[model samples]
Target: MDATSRHSKILDLLNSQERVEVEDLAARFGVSLQTIRTDLRDLSARGVLSRVHGGAVRVSSAANRAYADRRKQNATAKQTMAALLAEFIPDNCSLAINIGTSTEQAARSLENHRGLTVLSNNINIINLMMGGEAKELILVGGTVRQSDGAIIGEDAV
Candidate 1:
């Protein structure tokens, strides 16, 4: 394709990654090193990217969050699961739940149900249920697992 298209594509790839190797780009786009170099040069001239050793980094790369840290970035799935779990809860009935992140999501989903008794070993679930339609919130007190914020031990059983 043309230089403009190639430059745009290079910018797109750079946007997706903090650093992209020239060899990988060359293979992905079926182009030679010289062609990739020319595109990188054009992007650099436009101040859209800075050419690093064997790769290019986007101008905004410094502000982008690393992929490893972004694994827990959005909790959209959790929120959706919470909302869906609301449907299974019957009003004024007692429900027993385990200690887990997903279980907390299920408890959060029950926010709209009225006069419901929720028994859980999850601190987050108890806290969330405190101000909602929960008629009664029973927390099986025990040692809380800090890693996942779940209560676990003999007391929780």
Candidate 2:
């Protein structure tokens, strides 16, 4: 397969699997570990995935936020940050907000927007966005984390 196709496939796998090993991809794709690493590097550079010690993690704008505990620990700060960030987003735009407490706060901050499409993985965020004026809201499916209020696993794509 071409590099793009291969990268897409890799992303699909990473989205589905919590983690993937370099050797496994090399063996399954009949490529050398070096080639797999190169592909992973290119994909990571594009913000498609994050290179971890064992594998990669899918990258979403919401992925930039802190965990629920950290977010809740400073709810005021998160709310303030969300309010500030919300100012930069133009109306009637598509945005994929990841599943995290801070991102949830950000989503809540957008409640006044008239039209915005939000793709998310957090059920909590989705619940909040449902009450917003956004034109569209999409929840990426996968394993759900009740504690963190985010989704992770095979169905996230």
Per lDDT, the best of the predicted structures is: 2
Best by TM-score: 2
User: How do the residues 1-95 of candidate 2 rate in per-residue lDDT, one tens digit apiece?
Assistant: 67788788898897687666788888888888888888888988888788877567777554444564466567898899999989998899999
| Clash number by candidate, in order | 1, 2
* Candidate models: Cα lDDT each: 0.75, 0.80
On the 0 to 100 scale, the lDDT of residue 35 in model 2 is 85
TM values, all candidates: 0.49, 0.54
Backbone steric clashes in candidate 1, count: 1
TM-score (C-alpha, index-matched) for candidate 1:
0.49
Determine the C-alpha RMSD for candidate 1 after optimal superposition of all C-alphas. Answer: 13.0
lDDT of 1 by residue, 46-141 (tens): 777888999888675422444333324446876787777777668889998875555666777787889988788777778877886647988787
